[model samples]
Target: MTYLLICCRLLLGVVFLVAVTGKLRGPAAFTAFVSSVRRMRVLPAALARPAATAVVAAEATIVAAAAVPVHAAGVLAFATAAALLTALTAGIVTSLARGGQEPCRCFGTADTPLGARHVARNAALAAVAGTGLLAGLLAAPTGAGPLAAPVDPALAAVAAAGGAVAGALIVMLDDIVALARPHR
Candidate 1:
């Protein structure tokens, strides 16, 4: 269970870090993300860029919190992750309800158009975060409580690496889908 919790934390951290890095790849990349946010049509045009920046900043914070092995930080990070995923899911739902066709600026470079997949992905992430939050609270504990059985350091390290690799593969979903599509 300890190793599993570490795996989940690392997996989610890597995913969010990759997402932020992709969007911040260049000015054009960020502008495209902002444009995608605008296309969501959830906010006034004047607020789109600011909203995008805020979202990116929030994701960066999540990466930092989730990646660093700060004591008791995992609990907070999981909660934050859950909230972020929920908000993202809401945005996707709103876009879908409005019949939006904008590409999900999810991985920055992936041109995967918004669809049911986005909602499913976000919902899945939120569930992971929720579960992690519960598990982390018990495993890591707050101040002055009995700790769970310690995890083997070597095994934990391996799990961490595996989690990161899993995240990278998940981000490549678009490319994988593209390759599988029949050529025009």
Candidate 2:
């Protein structure tokens, strides 16, 4: 369970870090993201910029909270991550139902339009966050200190490596699917 928690924490942290970086990469990138938000039509046109900014801030917060070694912080971070992903998923679903074809700005300037795959991705990530939250809560000890118990070095290394690989795969999922499709 400890190793599982470690893997989940690292995975969420890496994913959110990549996501936040993608949006904050430059003025042009963020502007594009705001444009994508408006195109999604998830909120009023006037609120697009603010919504985009809030999304990026939330991602950054998840990353920061995941980095904290405290048990309670881990639990809170996972909870926040789950909630954010759920909201994003709902937005995607709404956009799809409205027949919006705007490209997803999720992990930077990807030309992949919103689709079922995007919904599945967000759902899967939310599940991971939920699982991490459960693990953290279940592992808590009565009167535990601020910091979590130290994990075995080898286990920690393995968990971190696994999480990194998973994060990379998720970030590249659209490209992976594109490559797998039959070229006309």
Report each candidate's C-alpha RMSD, comma-separated, in the order given: 2.6, 1.5
Clashing residue pairs, backbone N/CA/C < 3 A, model 1: none
- Per-residue alpha-carbon lDDT of model 1 for 69-159, expressed as tens digits? 7545677778888998998899899988999888989878766788897787788788878988888876654444222455577998998
The Cα error of candidate 1 at residue 126, in Å, is: 1.2
Q: After superposition, how far is residue 96 of candidate 1 from its true place, in Å?
A: 1.1
**Over the stretch 1-184, how does candidate 2's per-residue lDDT look in tens digits?**
8788878988999999999999999999999999999999989999999989989998998999989878888898899999999989999999999999999899889989989999999999999999999988888844444445656889888998898889888988999999999999
Regions of model 1 farther than 4 Å from truth: 142-149
Candidate 2: segments with Cα more than 4 A from true spot: 141-147
Candidate no. 1 TM-score: 0.89
Q: How many residue pairs clash in each candidate?
A: 0, 0
What's the true lDDT of residue 56 in model 2? 94
CA lDDT of 49 in candidate 1? 97
